[model samples]
Target: MSDHPMALIYGGTPHRFPMLLVDSVEELSEGLGRALKQVSANEVLLERFGDAPPTLPSCLLVDALGQVAILLLRERDGGAASVWYLGGIEAMTFHTAIPAGSVLRMEARVLKRWRTTARIEVKAWIGAVPVADGFMVLSQRGSGSNE
Candidate 1:
């Protein structure tokens, strides 16, 4: 869809609309990546909150960070068509609620990598305000069962 370089990266993956949270990639390197997610007032997820000012859910914020981690993993794999799964999350903290019409700036960095599993640290911000931060463990499909 978009002509941005990350579009090609995202296009090669299995993520799609409604669930694909990462909107754009600002930077991507070997073990780190930065991305953005624009929260719209009409977001389908906002419907779940009823009349709560259309704030983005905390879970989705973590998901957006995971998407960035996946992008980093995808880039590290040289754009290979590999499926990655979120195995676990640790020390996650939600500093504040994110409201609609806010742009989330997310960053993810690989902390360690083993045979089929990698640990990543992720954080998100709204302008200068930190919204969330956590560690995520991801495992590649078929390499081993994460469960």
Candidate 2:
């Protein structure tokens, strides 16, 4: 856990803010990763949803998990550049609705990896409270095979 700033992590990824869901990495290793996202009322998604009590969207949570998976893949590949795409999601369960102004912590672990595809399991928490978990399949883009 280097506590590397978001800028440094950004250098290792292709995401930019308003789209770069994870703010900072809390922990990162070859097969595991943990990151944070501070949900705010002024977030674009919340603004887009409009007029509702600011609830964090579940899709954003999944995207946060995907970002962690990308971080893990980058770490595993020693910062090799590859386009990673979300291939599929499985066994996803949402425990509770996440509200805006909450800090979301996400953790992901690589479950398996093949030639150009990796399977990861991820979970989200809000200050020690579990919110969601799921398994996702990610594939390196332009790998020459279609799902």
Runs of candidate 1 exceeding 4 Å displacement:
1-3, 47-51, 142-147
Candidate 1 — which pairs collide?
none
Q: What is the TM-score of each predicted model, taking all chains together? A: 0.88, 0.87
Local distance difference test, each candidate: 0.83, 0.83
* Candidate 2 structure, TM-score to reference: 0.87
Residue 146: error of model 2 in Å? 15
RMSD per model, one decimal: 3.3, 3.4
Candidate 2 local lDDT, 1-147, one digit each (tens) = 244576557855688877888888888877899888889878878534556678778888888889888888877876665678899999999998788889999999999999889999999999989999999999886423422
Reference-based lDDT, residue 104, model 1: 91
Predicted structure with the largest TM-score when compared to the true one: 1
